[model samples]
Target: MNNLRIVVRGGGDLATGVIHRLWRAGFTPLVLECASPAAIRRQVALCEAVYAGSATVEGMTGVLIHSLSEAVAVWQADQVPVLVDETAACVNILQPEIVIDAIIAKKNLGTHIDMAPLTIALGPGFTAGMDVHAVVETKRGHNLGRVILEGSAAPNSGIPGVIAGFGKERVLHAPAAGVLHVVQDIGSVVQKGQLIAEITTADGSVVPVEATLTGIIRGMIRDGFPVTEGFKIADIDPRQEELANCFTISDKARCIAGSVLELVCAYANKA
Candidate 1:
């Protein structure tokens, strides 16, 4: 097994793909996440370990741990460890050889090239060779997953990728600032105009969140999660066959993961 220490900042769905790939390649990658991660695709996100004791995606299990010692034990057990350190204070203590910023925040959140011997970030808002050693494309299209070593990835389009003829129509956003309570389970098929969730505002007024398209619930925020107005809350897939997609890493994620794996291997070879 490879003993190189890899620390991934963020445990969301996209980040989970990178973690899974690294682990499968014989590297024990530690995930750092916020105390409360608002991951819509919770089924495949290792950040679920923060809420539950552990989260299993495909066949890899990520166990939530408290201390550095527990992280080593989890690695020995062949499972990834999720640590709640959004600010990444543990990076200094762990002294990992690789640091990956996978927060997907579309903005650089304090990640720097000097964080480790090798540093990589995903999506836009990062400059390759400036803020990080490399940047992986996250936008959907011909350039998805391309590794940028000298510049930056494509700019955020603010538009969701078209899937089954539905683009922005498939994504659901909170209409008000309040607590969201989901009415439908993920993977459940629903019709347009159907009720999907409700938000209870501070004034005790309930705002209904309905489906904008007919399809399965691809993603949804956790029930009772406080959300701000316009916050992404759920996603609907117009393809009925996408029921299984809700529980697994997406093709786009896999594409990006492959690029990340390739970069890691290249660095490892040089070492």
Candidate 2:
């Protein structure tokens, strides 16, 4: 399609990557760089607009944010159908139709999700300018439910067990006695063996615990944050699975996908 306008925050390599993509996708990319006039001039020729300040929600006039928040807020236009995570860390912002946190895999910033929905892209490293990787498969669009985190195996134990994701999976009780140091909180993405808490033995021994597979942090036992032997930890997002470099949209549609979700999606990297 044509007439698509995207404003990318940050003028570094990441912004350039997204910009090139938007162009290929038929969208005009506007760069919002905090660099000097000369530094941006080279990129400006290919952009629709260039703002040289803190990208804010105010006066924001694009579909994305790569520079300032004020401009991003303004540009936070549209129903915000989806959030494509090209950023590095877990960004705690407003909300969108969907949030694709596809960067360097870390703790899931549960705060970044709002009513719409959350879906984590499953793949290798989470970084900038990668491809949108497709994790599991129930169907094409049907798989766009919960946000999946990094993990392998059958996906069972975690702060919240993997079973909890499907609302049917069962959670095995804690083995010994201890306080829940870091029980998986709702919204946190977890790995198969990631540290979820610190279980203390009756003998006064503290042991950091881990999960059994990859999934999103679904629920917790208490808010006080206890790390006990039998304390309930969290539920993992069941979306974790082996992902490839490309996925077919339908029976006759196909495109490229990335590990963390960096793609020429908006513009598929120009000529």
Candidate 3:
């Protein structure tokens, strides 16, 4: 087991995939996140620790920590620690050996190549050799997890990956701006045209958020969270036979996680 100090920014679903692999590989990874994370797949996201104090995904536990002391304690206990630091201010204090920006915000949020001895970023908005040491492909395709050493990943296509031949139809968006009220939660089997949620608009009138396709509720934002018109709020997986997939890391995420782990190991071995 490796005991390298790695600081990861973001605890969302995709970030959690990387964090999970790193922890399982013996690396002590500390996650940096915003005070309130907007993770839709709460079941598989380490950011859920922000609200529940701790969250378990596929047998890996992530604990919410505040200070350096708690971070070390969590590390010693073999649990990943999630810190609420959007700017990653703790990087200056912790001085970790490796830093990874897994925010998946589709744009750079202040991450730099000099943040650590070896810095890596996932997805677009980052140049491999300029903004960070390396960039991992996040767009679902033949190059999904390919590592880029000197260039940026593919640009965002403004579309979700196709699942079971259903692309945009698998994603749910808010029809109006308002507070969300969930009727069907994650992992629930939903049919097309079914009411899964409702949005309470400015006038207090509720608007129904229906399922666009018949499938399992793979993801859904927390109830009461404010959403804007056309904002992504849920996801439906057309494959109804794989219910456990809702709670497990996705194939795309695992592919990307493997690439991140490979890069970290490459650098660690060099040191």
**What clash count goes with each model?**
0, 56, 0
- For candidate 2, write residues 93-139 as lDDT tens digits: 43323334322122332213232233333223331122222222111
Give all candidates' CA lDDT scores: 0.93, 0.34, 0.93
CA error at residue 91 for candidate 1, angstroms = 0.8
Which is better, 1 or 3, measured by TM-score? 1
Q: Lowest summed lDDT over 10 consecutive residues: which window, candidate 1?
A: 67-76
How do all the candidates rank in terms of TM-score, highest first? 1, 3, 2
On residues 221-267, what C-alpha lDDT tens digit does candidate 1 reach at each position? 99999999999999999999758999999998899999999988998
Indicate whether candidate 1 or candidate 2 has the larger lDDT.
Answer: 1
How would you encode candidate 3's per-residue C-alpha lDDT over 1-271 as one tens digit per residue?
4667799999989999999898888898999999878898899999999999999999899999887678878877888889999999999998889999999999999999999999999999999889999999999989999999999999998899998999989989999999999999999999999999999999999999999999999999999999999988999999999999999999998999999999999999999
Which of 1 and 2 is the better model by TM-score? 1
Error of 3 at 18 (Å): 0.6
Return the TM-score for candidate 3, rounded to 2 decimals: 0.98
Candidate of highest TM-score: 1
Once fitted onto the true fold, the runs of candidate 1 whose alpha carbons sit more than 4 angstroms away are: none
- Give per-model TM-scores: 0.99, 0.25, 0.98
